[model samples]
Target: MSNLDSQTAYWDTAATTKTFTHPLHAPWLDDVNRHAAILDYGCGYGRTMEALAQQGFDNLSGVDTSPGMITQARALHPTMRFAVLDTPPTLARPDASILFAVLTCIPSNHAQKRLIAELSRVLKPGGTLYLSDLLIQDDERNRDRYARFAEHHDAYGVFETGDGAVCRHHPSDWFPSLLADFENIDTRRITVATMNGHESAGIQILARRPSQAQVGPVDSFTAGLEDR
Candidate 1:
């Protein structure tokens, strides 16, 4: 199977049965316009989008790789929009969007980088990307798994959970590097509850795409990617 399918396989069957609890901080959405286009990439069960809708924001679209999750989302929010996003990971929406808790679900380093590049492509100039993800934990249980997983995965912070889902935890410096293309607004460290019932340190970052004037020619950016 392809990597994308491997990544999503667990969620297809387990999403509806489990719950993801990522906290959305107030500052992350402080500047989002009410009518701006928002896409919750990796939106599991439409939870965050539902929260956004309740806060008065409109024009929201949620997409997940797992059909079961989309099934749950559409059923829960009949009036809201939700769709299943399959392999190749191209979003169907127009050129700009917001992402919440997307990075955590991606367990590979290269995949995370590719997703950031894709987000840069689809996000309109000045569009904001609000992100929340787990950080490498200091606890023994997590440390042991991180070490054990190194033998199986390319990155040290990625591991499979007891429930059979693969997940990634980030190093503090890695967050800034992953979002190198975006203009950072604010970052905060917070403790969070994991989907599998654990407390872990996590991060919240709010960043903005540079306006058109701030960016150089498209070829200049694409040139750097060709070699990679």
Candidate 2:
């Protein structure tokens, strides 16, 4: 099976059956405009979208890679729109139209970059993007696992789960450089409660797309009309 299929299957079967208690986007959700167009990329079972709707966000939409997840999301949220997509999503919205994005699911470097590019394509200049993902732990056990995973995968900090799915973790210092196109607003480490009732180290990032108005040099004063 392709990696996408593996990931879909992993989420549909294993992740679905477990208990998930993590709070989604708690740090940045309130800062978004209530009426702004929001995309919940990789929104599993539409939980975050549903929460956003409860918080009075009317322009919320979501996309997931697994059809099973989408089906469940539709059942749980009858009024909201959700799409099943296995590839990097191409949103119907025009360029610079989206105002907020909550991305929580990409694990590989290529997929992460691809989704970031797509988010950048759809999000308005000065729009906010919130991302949370696993971080490469500093312990020797994690180091050993990363070293072993390097033998099988081309990227760093990757590991194969017992269920045949691969997940990548990023170092703490990596995201600022990776998201250089955006203005880094904040980056912090937070403990997340996982499906298996374990606390894992995670990185939460808040970034804003640079506004077009801020791109060029600005003249502080009129150079030719100084003596008027």
Which pairs clash inside model 1?
95-122
Candidate 2 displacement at residue 27 in angstroms: 5.4
Error of 1 at 224 (Å): 25
Q: What TM-score number comes out for model 2?
A: 0.79
Ten residues in sequence with the least summed lDDT for candidate 1: 219-228
* Candidate number with greatest lDDT: 1
Q: What's model 2's lDDT at 78?
A: 91
67-126 in candidate 2: lDDT tens per residue? Answer: 777777788789887777655445453222221212223445665566566666556667
Q: If scored against the real structure, what TM-score would every candidate get?
A: 0.88, 0.79
The Cα local distance difference test for each model comes to 0.69, 0.57
Q: After TM-score superposition, what is the CA distance of residue 80 in candidate 2 from its true location, in Å?
A: 2.0
Candidate 2: misplaced stretches above 4 Å?
Answer: 1-6, 25-27, 93-107, 139-141, 213-228
